[model samples]
Target: MWLFVVLGAVLVLVGAVWALQGFGMLGGSAMTGSTLWAVIGPIVALVGLALIVIGIARRSRSS
Candidate 1:
């Protein structure tokens, strides 16, 4: 439970970073020639969101 929450948070952070770069808000990967990153950014973000939702749902069910 706690582990899930922590993992979800970390995924969210990583996703946000990837998304930022993909949207051209940040540097690094955005400037690189990887269209894969551009696509992956949003996907990662969604995955992160799903993870968070699952963690919350699991906790709520337990309590």
Candidate 2:
């Protein structure tokens, strides 16, 4: 449960960074302004959010 939360948080942060870079909002690499990253970043972030929600819900139910 805690592990999932931490993992999810990390994923979310990473996804956000990717998205920023993809959109050219945070330039400084080959991935910056890349269309592929722009598309994939949001999807990854959503998955992370889902994991966080699921982990928290499961933890609460078990408690």
Candidate 3:
């Protein structure tokens, strides 16, 4: 449960960075200004959010 939360948080941060880079908000990377990253980033973030929700739900249920 805790593992899920930790992993999810990391993924969320990574996804945010990817999205920013994709949108040209962040630079100096190969992914900057790439449309593919722009699309993939949000998807990854959503997945992370789902994992976080699952972790929280499971933790609450166990408690």
Candidate 4:
């Protein structure tokens, strides 16, 4: 469960960065202003959130 939570958090951060880059909010990368990342970023973030929720729930249940 902890693993899930940690991995999820990492994914969420990465997704946020990707989203920012894709939207041109962050620069200095090829991904900056790319439409593909803009679309995929939120999806990855949502998956990360789901993993976090699952991890928490599993932890609670195990306890």
Candidate 5:
């Protein structure tokens, strides 16, 4: 339960930063190569959100 929440938070933050950097919103020169985080960050964030929701629902049902 708590784990999901933590992971979700981390993912959301990482995803946001990656998305920002990837989109050049940070206003910096592009790197020589593509960064995987730009893809991974959002995916991880979604997974984390799903995990958190599932955990919450499961806990609620059990209780």
Candidate 6:
């Protein structure tokens, strides 16, 4: 549903930011350069991508 798409988009955006911060590409945070965030960020982004795919698939089926 639209909700899934919205949530997925938000997650992707947040994950990207977290990843950037974790990689020290984006500064000004305690999480900057943290290995934990660096690892988890990609996972979260992947999950968001999955959600978006699932939402689109369902939408297409329903239509």
TM-score of 3: 0.97
Please, what are the lDDT tens digits per residue for candidate 3 over residues 1-63? 998999899889889999999999999999999999998898888889989999999999999
Residue 10 of candidate 2: its Cα lDDT? 84
Model 1, position 15, has a per-residue lDDT of: 71
Over 4 Å off, model 1? 29-33
Candidate achieving higher lDDT, 4 or 6: 4
TM-score of each: 0.74, 0.95, 0.97, 0.97, 0.65, 0.96
Tell me the lDDT of candidate 1: 0.73
Q: What's the lDDT for candidate 6?
A: 0.90
lDDT of each: 0.73, 0.89, 0.92, 0.93, 0.67, 0.90
* Residue pairs in collision within model 1: none
Q: Write the per-residue lDDT of candidate 4 for residues 1-63, one digit (tens) a residue.
A: 999999999999999999999999999999999999998888889889989999999999999
Q: Per-residue alpha-carbon lDDT of model 2 for 1-63, expressed as tens digits?
A: 988888888889888988999999999899999999998888888888988998999899999
Clashes of 2: 0
For model 2, the local distance difference test gives 0.89
Strongest candidate by lDDT: 4
Better of 2 and 3 by TM-score: 3
What clash count goes with each model? 0, 0, 0, 0, 0, 0
Candidate 4 wrongly placed segments (more than 4 Å): none
lDDT of 4 at 21: 92
lDDT of 5 by residue, 1-63 (tens): 667667767777766766666655654546212366566656766876787787788778878
lDDT of model 4, residue 58? 100
| Candidate 2 all-Cα RMSD | 0.6
Lowest-lDDT window of 10 residues in candidate 6? 2-11
